[model samples]
Target: MSSSVPPSIPRQPAAGSKKQSAETATGVTKRVAPGGKHALTETEKRGYALGVELGSDVARQQMEVDPKFLMQGMADGFSGATLLMTVEDINGILAEIQ
Candidate 1:
């Protein structure tokens, strides 16, 4: 499937935005800074939590995953940005691991 990147990622809010809302998993809402910089939305928060949990699992399994690449892949996937690697590349990596 094809997808396009969003104007801004969760970590970086769009410029000139008045306010950004941050809703936690517990449903608590808070306003970000005046410029709404470095604020994450509810979806972003959940995605981050899930990412952390999965990362922990990978660590527990003693998997040697590069944090930089893993984060980049997650960002690309979430923002619909062009993937750094092709499907075949990913398959080949997985095959090697297997």
Candidate 2:
């Protein structure tokens, strides 16, 4: 019988990968109206995102946020890590954009 493994997954290891031995980083994409007037006007805001494989040892709620959403207009992303701000600043992320 064939191993029931996903074909898209790679089984090799990188010499200098930062992730754990069993975990791999997954990328996802999402597209959502930045939280602004439009976001309030439009009930449904779509978000595109990538997946980060946390590994089999733990349980994770899988979700994707588009890379574009990580831009300056959205959240303050730096050095690959997304930043969080106070409710005031966060709520106005896309305020100027739209």
Candidate 3:
């Protein structure tokens, strides 16, 4: 006699969706790659968070902001300064911006 159980179908990712969400069910943010290609490298995630924090600080200054220019400036600054900086140093910079 044959068994009556059916096979399970595999699930597939949606079309054109290359990366999965970086957050967890507990509402913690998982760091995805800077460009979302794969798992986040430390530099990539730090750089992104630095940019976001600094950009928000700038926005609160009420100046006209160009996002591309702002991001490029932050990238350049981080490239040179990150190696020599601490989180406190970065926070000081953000605090002094206003």
- Highest lDDT, which number? 1
The RMSD of every model to the true structure, in order and in angstroms, is 9.1, 19.5, 18.3
Candidate 1 displacement at residue 94 in angstroms: 2.8
Which scores higher on TM-score, 1 or 2? 1
The residue ranges of model 3 lying beyond 4 angstroms of the native Cα positions read 1-38, 75-98
Model 1 C-alpha lDDT versus the unseen true structure: 0.67
Model 1 agreement with the true structure over 8-75: per-residue lDDT tens digits: 33455457756667764445454555743457899998886786566656666679987767767777
Clash number for model 2? 20
lDDT of 2 by residue, 8-72 (tens): 43544346433323322332232222333233223242232122322211223333433344343
What 10-residue stretch in candidate 1 is worst by lDDT?
1-10
Give all TM-scores, in the order shown: 0.49, 0.19, 0.35
The TM-score leader among the candidates is 1
Which whole-number lDDT from 0 to 100 does residue 12 have in model 1? 53
TM-score of 1: 0.49
What stretches of model 1 exceed 4 Å from their correct place? 1-45
Comparing 2 with 3 on TM-score, the higher-scoring candidate is 3
Query: Model 2 scores what on Cα lDDT?
Result: 0.35
